[model samples]
Target: MLHRLKEFYDGPNKDAKKFYNLVEEANQELYPGCTGFSKLPFTLRLYLLKCLHGWSNKSFTSLLKLLKEAMPELNIPPSYNKTKSTKIDACLNDYILFRNDHKDDDFCHTCGASRYIQSTEVDSELVPSKKQHRVSAKTLRHFPLIPRLKRLFMCSKTADSLRWHEEERSKDRKLRHPADGLA
Candidate 1:
């Protein structure tokens, strides 16, 4: 298991090189001129495997375990770390443009209210703790929009209309997309 994990991370094989190249491009763009070592390659590889190969969160955690068992020297992030995945997913979402048409109000569209406070009785019954406590009550699984947009750009068979904005791209372009008009 350790040998296989190291092969995937540091081997000179074609697939390993491809993985290295992907991480290289991402880190170069994210931290220009950064040449120091980082654990990001491992993290990004996990993320890519999940995205490209459709690995579930549980599967991802298992991979980390295998890597740890084999290497015993790696610093894999903690299992079930919500913040790690959230930060990576947020970075991936930055390039996406929202297409939904909605009013700019804090109120919910369905309830037309500013907030939906849960009942204190229900909260106490569920928590049953005197001291304040925090818990993650929900997790949302979403297909990131930016990668879908990037795939459109990668395919040579796409219509020219998709690249129409490239010719008119400006260094300081303003209000070029609907999102730019958002408050």
Candidate 2:
């Protein structure tokens, strides 16, 4: 593994080799991630994750040196020797992108709300869960998405007969006379 670590060269121009996801689009400009310390740039943050995944601290430190030799802008090279405070603080904000914490039900998939609507809600069938998910028969085999299906209930595009049952309470409240509030 040490031999391969020193020799491995995954770069943008080299499609034959696969770079880890964090570093896959290093050169591309991402929304500036949480301001991390160690003065390391976001791209270098990705590089460190790749190194830490497999290599030990000592080997990672050595590898960081080699990377430093190649790219002057990479800031501090991988430092397995650094204090835990320094190492931990350095990666604090960069993990946000990895976790995809921005998954909001309200603004999902801006293109056309891919997940929230179905053409035919009542007649739609549940997709069978992949066999890999079967731990025990007691576990839910197929959970149908109903709330997402509800959005289409309001739209009468495909189902001409579908009716939106709206309670006429809010409209009546707005039309009430001011004298109703007298004590």
Candidate 3:
């Protein structure tokens, strides 16, 4: 495994070969349940590698094609089309205020109001747990923006700019970045 890592580090065209091997190795190492890439029911490891590398579906597809040819012994997923579509469908399963139907019956049963219309309202602590239960399960998984913005500050390149809000504030200041928050 050390040899593979060293060879991978020194290898030319590092993007193509090393990524597949590393993903395969990591999958086997991390997940003891699955035997290897081919045996796993889901393409979770491949998806996670793409996420960690910040590769787009198209770029991952190209890499996957290269892997299929270079390592015939490895059983990798064929294309990104199905994988991407499935991910997209999963993400899109959540309801959007602007896009989804808002019939009057969708209102709160007790208050007869659309209290859960805005994402902020849905996520707010002010909303009772019982009321929260009234929200659609799909909408419950709506991704929060604050954590994602905070993650930007976690990166080395952006960490220096963590205090940019304070440094660059105007007289009529408004919250533009996550760093502006007291938390």
Candidate 3 local lDDT, 1-183, one digit each (tens): 998799668655644564455444333422334332232233556778889989988898888789768866555566876544221111123333322234333444443444343454465565556454433322322233554465567677687677655666653545665655567
Alpha-carbon TM-score of each model against the true structure? 0.30, 0.22, 0.29
Clash counts per candidate, in order, are 1, 0, 0
Provide the lDDT at 19 for model 3. 45
lDDT of 1 at 148: 47
Candidate 2 on 16-119: residue-level lDDT in tens?
23333323332233333422322324434645686678767676667767866786555543464531221111112222211134323222333322222233
In TM-score terms, which candidate is top? 1
For model 1, residues 1-183, the per-residue Cα lDDT tens digits are 987887677548674575566444333322333333235544666778788998878887787778768866555554636315432111112332111232223234554433223334446666676554322222233334554466466667573668555654553648877644547
RMSD of 1: 17.2
lDDT of each: 0.49, 0.38, 0.50
Worst 10-residue lDDT window, candidate 2 = 134-143
User: Which runs in model 3 stand beyond 4 Å of their true positions?
Assistant: 1-34, 39-42, 85-183
- Estimate candidate 2's RMSD in Å: 25.3
lDDT of 1 at 161: 63
Give per-residue lDDT, candidate 3, residue 166: 62
How many residue pairs clash in model 3? 0
